[model samples]
Target: MKIDMSNLKFGAVEKPEKIGNEYFAVVPYFFTLKCNVSSMNDDMKKKIGAAVIQKYGKNNVQYLAAEGAYLINARMRACAISPDRKTWKFVILEKEYKSQLVKVLPKKILDKI
Candidate 1:
């Protein structure tokens, strides 16, 4: 089933900034579920990253992290999915916060990936 996006509302995008050698941008989150940032296990982190990719796409998804480690996935970067905490903050030097365009993607869009 597809979600009704007629009333979609996108959250605000934060100003981009440079940290060390990377540029990062924050956007108002679009997800409905989030695990505690400081309490996730490796499996939980992967699942969270996957949930984001399913809604945003692989190219749009970036860093995946738990409390212990951070994993970077680049097919050469961008994806978002859930709760107010379910947002991506990655090496924005070559990435874009596509969440400014829409709240959620449809099944057909997810299938093409």
Candidate 2:
């Protein structure tokens, strides 16, 4: 699975700086990611998460714990399917403490925006 986090909001921690003797400085920071999900398959998702864990270290990816584990399909765009297909919930991130809920907009809407 190709997981692209190109549009997701996220936080990041800075590397620790070593000082002389036994002192060190550590800084924690947060940043939003333009994340994307790709090549979504169940097993592939697991591998992608594992890869993220490896790259960002376990602590960094811990935020995902609240959201649960899911796979990212890089090639797949979040588009609405026919009624016969299962409909999924849609959400838009808000800068405020709370998120804004919205129904899935039609593909045409995306094109306009």
Candidate 3:
């Protein structure tokens, strides 16, 4: 998804944090994408789930407790895609910490994987 940076409305973040290189802005839960994760096809869900599991993990309980994500919730940070995998950047919520740039596998590619 293409996130409009200018239109983003942050929730309770007092200030943005610089984790390493990228810059992230905190936002409220209200701004999260409204879509049914289960509504997606098995392959698509599997792809996204795999990406999530790879980045996060397959253990739902462990993922939730360790990653600060709730069970059954797919948390997504606004990211900018680039041809070079090293350029992918995302903004984390809460502290608005900018995570390290990593490859963001597209949903289509994830299905094929």
Candidate 4:
């Protein structure tokens, strides 16, 4: 099933937190994409990473090989994992600090993933 990110709403903001002299607002938004695949491997990672780079630009996307994840930006990430041997799960989360919220994921990106 395809998700329409524009229709998805943000959850309630948490209580503000103070660090030193700065106060920050924590707003979290997340979504999951499920795929039926035989396995989650390096080739799959590259394909997903390429889609992210194409959408967000190469300079904005960082791949963490050790974590098997892509940090899409300072506030967002798309991580792939296998719950068993046949299911592939992409957990895309945008948890922004200081109220700089990321409210949508592009349909093109979703289709690519």
Candidate 5:
């Protein structure tokens, strides 16, 4: 499946940084973006969640309320988290690399995938 990055809307996105195999040997392509915001509030989460649902379809997006994250298509993973009060890190791992990393994922996350 091809993910059209342009279709997904976001707020205050900074230039994305390409992630390499040093982080995870299995996934050949990975990248992360920083979404700068004033605070990590419910509204921000709601907006990002909405954008994800809009881009991937509600049926393919699963919201993990406990983790405050969204898992897409059971193969592709997308989640935004606040590392600090002013920055939200948005990480997206392409689905094409999932098969190689399946065995390394925790059981909890693997079950959802």
Candidate 6:
């Protein structure tokens, strides 16, 4: 999904905080995905996983379906937008953040990744 950025809307956010090299801002994920995670095939999943790792760096990226969500729900301050992973969303705390995180990245970026 080539996100227009402008079409996307963000929910309320807490005050921003600086963690490591990035500033963190907490916001809610409003189930805005072109497709659902449960239906994606392995190849597709791998493709998305790799693209995410590339943009966010393997060490800095994560996928929180259920368990992962629980783990990050308390302390994570950084999140990748559903599609390209080019945009990073920061949240102050985990309890309030939410997203389906399933957006199609640009074809050019996908080829490079």
Q: What lDDT would each prediction earn against the true structure? A: 0.40, 0.35, 0.37, 0.44, 0.45, 0.38
Q: How badly does each model clash, as a count of residue pairs?
A: 9, 18, 0, 0, 0, 7
Query: After TM-score superposition, what is the CA distance of residue 99 in candidate 6 from its true location, in Å?
Result: 32
> lDDT: which is higher, 1 or 3?
1
- My TM-score estimates for the predictions, one after another, are 0.27, 0.28, 0.26, 0.32, 0.32, 0.27
Residue 91, candidate 4: Cα error in Å is: 23
Q: Where is model 5 more than 4 Å wrong at Cα?
A: 1-39, 74-113
Model 4 TM-score, all chains together: 0.32
Error of 2 at 35 (Å): 4.1
Model 2, 70: alpha-carbon shift in Å? 7.3
List residue ranges in candidate 3 displaced over 4 A.
1-35, 61-113
Residue 85, model 2: lDDT of 27
Ranked by lDDT from best down, the candidates are: 5, 4, 1, 6, 3, 2
Question: Which candidate do you rate higher for TM-score, 1 or 3?
Answer: 1
TM-score of 1: 0.27
After TM-score superposition, the amount by which residue 103's alpha carbon in candidate 2 deviates from its true location, in angstroms, is 52
Q: How well is each residue in 1-113 modelled by candidate 5, as lDDT tens digits?
A: 12222233333432333232112112122222223332457888688778767766787676567655556653234433343324654345445556754644433333333
Q: With candidate 1 superimposed using the best TM-score fit, by how many Å does residue 36's alpha carbon deviate from the native?
A: 7.6
lDDT of 1 by residue, 1-113 (tens): 11222222346654554443434444343332222333566677678677757756776555523333333232322223322334553322122433433334333222322
Compared with the true structure, what per-residue lDDT tens digits does model 6 show for residues 13-94?
A: 5454444344434454432222223456667756776765654456544565652211111112333323233466432223
* Candidate 3 lDDT (Cα, 0 to 1): 0.37
Q: Which portions of model 6 show Cα errors greater than 4 Å?
A: 1-36, 65-113
Regions more than 4 Å wrong, model 2? 1-30, 34-39, 62-113
All candidates in order of TM-score, best leading:
4, 5, 2, 6, 1, 3
